[model samples]
Target chain A: MKIRELLTRWVGFVALGIRRTALRATHTARQRIRFSGLGVAVAIALLVMVTGLSVGLATSTTVYDDDIDYWIVPDSESPESPLVATDSPQFSSVHETNDRITAIDGVESSTPVLAQVLRVGTNESDEYVLIIGVINSPALEDVSGLNTDSLTPHDPYYGDGEYNGTWTGDAVLSEGTAELLAVTTNDSVTIAGNRSFTVTDIESQSSDVGNVPTALVQLSELQHVTGATTYDQADQFVVSTSSPAVRDDLEGIYPQSSVQSRGEMTASSTRNSDMALALAATALTVALVIGTLFVVTTSGLELVADRQQLAVLSAMGISVGSQIRLVGAQTLVLTGLGGIVGAVCGIGGIRLINAVAVRTITTEPIAVVSPWFVPYGTGVGLFVGLLSLPFLVVVTRRVTGGKLG
Target chain B: MAGSVASFDEASSSVVVSATDVTKRYTRGTEPGVLGRLLGRQSPPTVCAVDSASLEVRTEEIVGLAGPSGSGKSTLLHLLAGLERPTDGTVTFRGTDLASLSRRERTRHRLEHIGIVFQQFHLLDSLSARANVALPLVETGVGKRERRRRATDLLERVGLGDRITHRPRELSGGEQQRVAIARALITDPELVIADEPTGELDTEAGRTVLQEFERVAENRAVVLASHDRETLELCDRLLRLRDGSVVDQSPPGGSQ
Candidate 1:
């Protein structure tokens, strides 16, 4: 009963406060409230967008990393040479090394994928494409679904039974590469010094960067045509595991090579996108600071101006605490409501920025704007709330002076 | 009802306010300079706002406290209302010493038992007449429906039924003062203090306000401070002040 009564009283007070004031309390500075509310809203919305984008980016990379348990790279690796140099003969052969790592415990599946930046010319332009070599089996089948009915890697132009030992018959093209080359299944493409192979299936790869066309061939055939010494001699190895524990097993097996986890690779790929994070932080900080200052100054100044009225209320049974609440509640409602609205606009603003800037990052054709933006919006609103408190406390205490009739 | 406060001394069950030897002093100037302090000067010149004055009021009486401006009429009221601490005396209300009560206690007491109407009306400009009248119940934790009901009833009785939803600015002076009266009586406090309640109203409005005050004093004791003859005429007894001291105490309806 007491609780019910308290709620009722607070409701009445809130109603009174809201009705008496304009957007804020009569004691609150109007311009300050308007601008502060706007600022808080904007800041909150932007904060939500930034956090969502960051978390999404992290989640996408984490998914990729979790899929690939191990990476095998040359020991002396750097930005200059992502792969072992072509002239290095000993580095040119790695089939025995592949076999050695495949036999390890918890090795669910292993495939030798040769990734090289081979420039291909399309009707419109020429660009570099990554190529991989796969050993057709149930293990590689589980992760990539490359040899299954879904991708249809075994049809004509893709492969024949005898070509497992050779790269002569056909090859598979990655979805992106096939789209770029404007080629269909059964199309033929020349490769590796005049050797031609039929395009059997269009494959999709998580590792392939956006818009890059990829070529896949049987390892032995690629080694034969390109004059590569061994089946694993070409690019990097793609390893899939049923669980994360095999990552350590693969690392222990291939101790001499460097392994790039999915996270590290994606981070490296999206390094240029860090500007988004920085911009978000700066926007939130600027909005919160400016909004807080606007609200506090306006609220504080208005209370000072109406000191006499406050004194009268104080003298007429209005407690100092309730008086403070009366003022604080007004600030909260105005700014909090403003925050919700501003966050919505902030999201639209972000989309606008993205549309104008014209950058290709995600696989989607255009920007993916998140619809719900409460996390950032609430953050901005909370900051505004804190800012309004000091002014509220000071003003109420000063005016009431702990006096009553 | 008139001349009822003379029985304040003998009444054991109905005493509302009791102040004994209340004294308050202001210190001399203490400005930001060495010479001012060297001359024994403070920021403000030392003066007595209220000397040792002991007075009491009983239930169902209206006691008029008349004094010149700055003669501590307001100070003595503040002291009796538990708004200020006496430098050298004690004030008791209903057997509870005002000096002994905590801040919260005093506040609660003021909210539940004392109704004060000031000269300026002090109506919250944002609130309508009904909401303004319901404020004391906010402290009492009453439900909104009940509070509004009581407030509407009070406002209607005060001849403001048509203006219940109008804010203070929308109402005339008489209507606003009526709202103030409604606010003061909402809690049905035992003691009602009116400090120059009608000082700001026109003569007719002032008279109407006094009649409303008279209606409130039917059950509770009213301690009214005013120099206005009309306000004193409504009081049950007159306690006149000269130089911060009570100069005369006349019976109800008596000539000064």
Candidate 2:
């Protein structure tokens, strides 16, 4: 019975503390509520935006929008690294490996990709553009931000290692590259100032690849131009498969190559690059430090100002534990309110970051807001409130030490 | 003057609280710092707030602690109310030593058996007069409906039924004190301690509060510290203090 009574009293105290805190918050909305809440909200907003930007930059290495499940890159290179211009020893037999990978049960299709930076120019100026050579397959037809239909009627004979067999001087340009070169469909451009190719189509800027200037040509043409015809060499293979078992098969195809699933590729790339994580951690630390300072100082001052009221409660036999809980509840209510406002501000921050990035750096957004960040931001706010608890307890104890006056 | 008073009806009334030779001392200034210690400095001076005071408060009596400013009346009242432990003596409430109880246990004892009122009428500014009355009951785990009903009844009894919804700032000083009295009596404690409860009120308002105190003192013991003669006249007995010691103890109608 005694235990039950104690538990009941505790429940009553918590409920009363919550109600009183909320009432006091609303009553003193101007002096108490707005001061701490707005400070915390701004901090959380900046943290959320920083986190979004970090995650976006970390995941931005996925340049292919096609539903390719795995990227087979040379072990000496990374998928997230800027396209490797030089061929590795493993790059020599990629075409033969691609053919073998297509025979796997779960492997729906495979294509060898050769990526190189070439200086393509107009009569007025010239600029370096990334050129990717891919086989004309159904997988390429469905790629986002790429118009491969214009390359159709040109069959899939590029991997045959004979550039003169079925030559079509057809090439596609990314909208960004097209704009940079001031070229349109049917406009002719010189590759390395030797080979001429017609721009068959212009694809828009893709979210996966951002605004990097890029061009696509037939694999055989790129091999012929890059002088890799001796070994049918390519940089990497893009494989589309629905089964996890295909990963093991792809990993064994070459001695000095790696097979990475989409998520694995993202994690691997992000893990190797510490700059983004450091930036995010720094942003989070700055935000938490600012928020903790604001809450502690404001709450400490408030407690000192309200010492007499706490003394009155103490005199009336209210327990010290209850008083501390009251302070905690008040802190949480303020920070929670701030969290809600911060979430809204964070969304706006994400948009502003994207807009600024498009103008200054990439043609796509530099930051993308994850839906989970809403709750993460709010939870962090609550954690900050909890962090302010020890300071509040010290203040309360000092103020209510057996003195009413 | 050095003796204690036990003036209530011996056969019918029982002691609710008793204090014996209670002395409370307070240091005057900050403690000596590291430089002072290195120079062999002495500690801060001390003053006796309450000195060797003895008293017994029985049920069915209104005991007034009367004195001038800094006469130790408030300190003595606090000692009797178990708000502070005496520096050199013991206080027992209902046969249990308050000094022996843990801080948590003492708080629980006060919550269950003692109610205190302050001179400043420390009602939460945000809570309504009714909610203020119900505040103690909330600690006792009373249901909301019952807490509200009892609070409303007390407010009506204190003649503030119409002001139940009013916050402390909206109410007059007397009304706030009445609300404090209602809050004190909400838990129906065995003893009620008030420190200059009427100090902030006018004569008319003070009288109304005194009348409510008289009503509340019919069964439980009441110990009020006040300098007002009008307030003391309503007490059954008065203990007047001077310079941290009790100088006189007598019935209000008798010579001190």
Candidate 3:
């Protein structure tokens, strides 16, 4: 007779669903559903981890300074498929070649850079840092987002082209390095096999280098200490120039190397970034497929074993439509709960992976988690649950046979 | 047979369910495909599970179906309860033809009018005794408080008040059957069809369960299918079925 009463009567199926689903599963049925959910959680957690890593690789391909316009990297492989190798081709006579490039028109500055994961503290402690070798010049003020002008500049350690030069031992530590060693500016710390360097500045690194433990040291000093002074070997060279014609000269400096201007670098990086996202999407699809199949098999077996209970329900005058509603409600509850748990687990996993990468590689993160990853992972879980509905329908039909005893 | 047949025309408002010339036939084996038949495979045989048998059950009467295993007693009861359709003839509940209704309509018709009890109990392992009793009313859209209160009271009436929270696995065979009976009666259905209610119980448990059924029959008509001799002694009238046919019908304590 009343609007509210009519509305309540129309929504009676909701009451039926709540009363029959996992919220009121029998002890035995609950055990079955919980195991199914745990399996989905593990699959979803793995998907989240792989996707996070893929995103990290895409967004964090750079370890050079934010302002560097060109990079001369060894072109041993195609630039499109560049792989970060621990040991690779380098430029001999990099200092002289960089000096020539610096003389060209529109060239503001040029510097040779060498990056190695070398131990920083004493042998008793195990702390490795990304020791970057660069010429600290006023014209080029930053390397990997840390102030480099505080360090000694220009050939101070390459006196007479011999190993007997005055070593300033002045180093600029990234914020992460300062916190790792518990040191401040003006404090002396052991590095590169017990050679003590005074901390000149501790600057917070830019987003380009991520949260790596980094330090900027003079180029020739790093080369002399690391026994790489034979050909002035460096990993790569960063050049600052405004003229597009300057790239051709930089390319000719090393015939076997390749030059990537700012625009070209961003395009290549974008391609790599797109590939990474594609990889993450594939992993997510795989996780969802595996999760769906597992739930179907397990839930099918459970329904087969509990057919008699379904028979009982059918005999009690409950319609097949009502039974379906109850089963669908149960599946949603199980997967929804698993998704929440898996997202939480995935968040923890991302942090753990990033921490390990920082400790070992110390330059670029291997995985990064975003705020949206939680809801995304949960959505994946629900999608997996929805995928298993056809199997569930078949099982429901088989159990609720036409003839009731 | 004394007091065996009731005239169909004599049926009135007191008649809850009447099966006239009802028969149920089931195929015995799977049919061979054409290739199998070419290889000398035989055709599947058909077995008549229930012959053309007429019966009228009035409200408040305890009608017992007595037969040995594999007889038509259970099949006849199934037809009367609208649990299965008859191969021939008509089964009408409260003057409505059950065969005319769709599967969903038939189910609803059964739900609103009839209660059923199985030999194996068929209790849900996940639900407690009280929840099992309250299950049928959930589809009826009864309020939670009312369902709980009614289920609790019914469990107490069935002598399972203390076992209300216990799951079916935790209860004894007689206790579980009593819970099932309580589940059936919870909706206050007009007709109760019980198939071998004591088939899985011991002598003592069976007697206790039979006593509960006796009390259940006080409020509704009971069509009980069982082979046990003493179970039939509690019935007002007995129908003896042999080889899918009702051979004779008589009052209890009389020769079949």
Candidate 4:
């Protein structure tokens, strides 16, 4: 009941404030309020857009396949954001590790992945394509967006851990690679100078981390061609599992590597967290400073101009506390409106960034927008209103000096 | 001069407001800052706006304060209504001394017990006539629907029902003052103080306001201050001031 009464009183005060603001006749006062709202809106928009960019950077992944539930990457590995890291610490004897992980209960399939940028093209032209070698299995669907149905399963090219097995010469090319090299599904392309492969399928897909030309091939074949065959080394292993408990087993399989679940794809879990967080923090601070300053400055000017009105209300027996509440309600209304507009502009900014990213070289979305941005922006706006109260209180007290009593 | 308060019938026992030997003095020069105060600067010249004024009115009495310009009519009204505390003496509203309370408490007491109509028709230009009339009710924590209902009814009573939605800037001077009167009466205050309420209006508007006051004065006690004799003629009792002191009064009382 007490809560209800407080809400009722606040509603009354807010109604009074809004009526005054909406029906006010002075053009300067209206312009002041409009500029304050614009300042808050622009600030919130920038904050939300910057946050979306940070989220996009954090969620970027090299393994684009949806079914891959976990990644076992070396703990010392660097930058997965934008996924252009050339070399990093590798997991040795990945075949042994993959076997151990696949034997775990609830495990669907485990494929050790090795990524290397290699020149793959016809004799006429060549393009440096990101080639990911994964041992395709009946349980796997795709790798780096390349469909794995046509690739030889189980990496038959590795005969008893030796390079003596038959080379399948089967490759799956992304549409980017197909376009870059001007090749089709039946075309042949040579890689690493002496090794050649037949393009069995062409899929229009970009690397999940960012847009890039890519191809998929059998693990051992590329290992032999790239000299990763020394210890059956691979950059990481992608696991498709039905149970989350398999993450613990994957973690224990390789002592030097860390198991990354899909849920851990945030800035904090990534190596580039400092940069992403800095960008986000800068955006927040700028919004805070700009928003708070605008609210205080505009409200002060407005209250000063309404000094006579304040005096009149004081004469009408309005206590200073009640007067503050009325003014506070007006500030909240102003900032709240600004927040809604800012959130909309921010969402549009995120979409624009994503669209431009797709049309240009960055084929994947580099910004993420969420529905919660509206409420968060409005919350910040309310905070700005609260912050402006001390200044407004001083001004009110000046105008309603003890002379009235 | 201090003991010259007029005596009337036994109706003083029911006095809604009583001012006894009230004096208000204002310093008219530059007040000393911290440095000047530290240097023992002399006090500025002072002007006594109200000096040893005494009067009282009972229920249903329409008391008038009449004097030429600068005769303290408005100052006495301000003191009586608790808008400004007297520098000396006491002002009691329904038996409680107003000068003994804090500024906020005094203001609250005025809000609850006294309603005032100013000479300038000080209605907020941003608010509609109905909203302006409901301004006092807002401070008293009245609900919006009820405030609106009461304000609209009061405006209708004042012949401004059609102008409820019109902003002050859109209303004529007489219509604005009428709205002010409705605002003053909305609180059902024990005493209504009008300081030259019709001073800014033309003869026609002033006559209309006087007629409204005649109707309003039927049940409630009013203390109206004006220099116009015609305006004061409507009062049941009259107090005349000269140089901030009440020199004469009518209705079988001597300078009450």
Best by TM-score: 2
lDDT of 2 at B230: 91
Say which candidate scores most in DockQ: 2
lDDT of 3 by residue, B1-256 (tens): 3333354344577888898999899888798998999999998788999998888888789999988888888789888878788999999988999999987888888788999999989887667899888878767767667888999999999889999999898999999999999999988998999999999999999999999988988767899998888889989999988988888899989896
Per-prediction count of colliding residue pairs?
Answer: 12, 0, 1, 0
Q: Model 4 segments beyond 4 Å from truth?
A: A1-7, A18-29, A60-264, A267-272, A350-372, A401-405, B1-10, B28-30, B37-40, B66-73, B120-132, B162-172, B199-207, B226-233, B238-256
For candidate 4, give the lDDT. Answer: 0.81
lDDT of 3 by residue, A1-405 (tens): 256533433344445444445544444557666788887888888888887777666645344555788988777665532323445667677677777877899988778888777888832454788788887666887877888779877858875456577889888998778877888899887776768888999998754344457888988878877878887778788888878788888888766678986546544543557787687878888888888988888778877776766777888987676676667666766676678778889878988887787777654356766666788878988888789877898789878844544
- What C-alpha lDDT, on a 0 to 100 scale, does residue A183 get in candidate 4? 89
lDDT at A398 for candidate 2?
Answer: 80
Worst 10 residues of 1 chain B by lDDT: B1-10
* lDDT by residue (tens digit), candidate 4, A83-159: 22245578777777777888899999889999888988797888887788898788888776677999978888886
Question: Per-residue lDDT tens digits of candidate 1, residues B101-128?
Answer: 8766777778888888888788876667
Worst 10 residues of 1 chain A by lDDT: A154-163
Q: What lDDT score belongs to each candidate, Candidate 1 first?
A: 0.67, 0.79, 0.79, 0.81
Query: Which 10-residue window of candidate 4 chain B scores lowest in summed lDDT?
Result: B1-10
Off by over 4 Å in 1: A1-32, A45-293, A358-368, A386-391, A402-405, B1-12, B28-44, B251-256
- Looking at candidate 2 chain B, the ten consecutive residues that score lowest on lDDT are B1-10
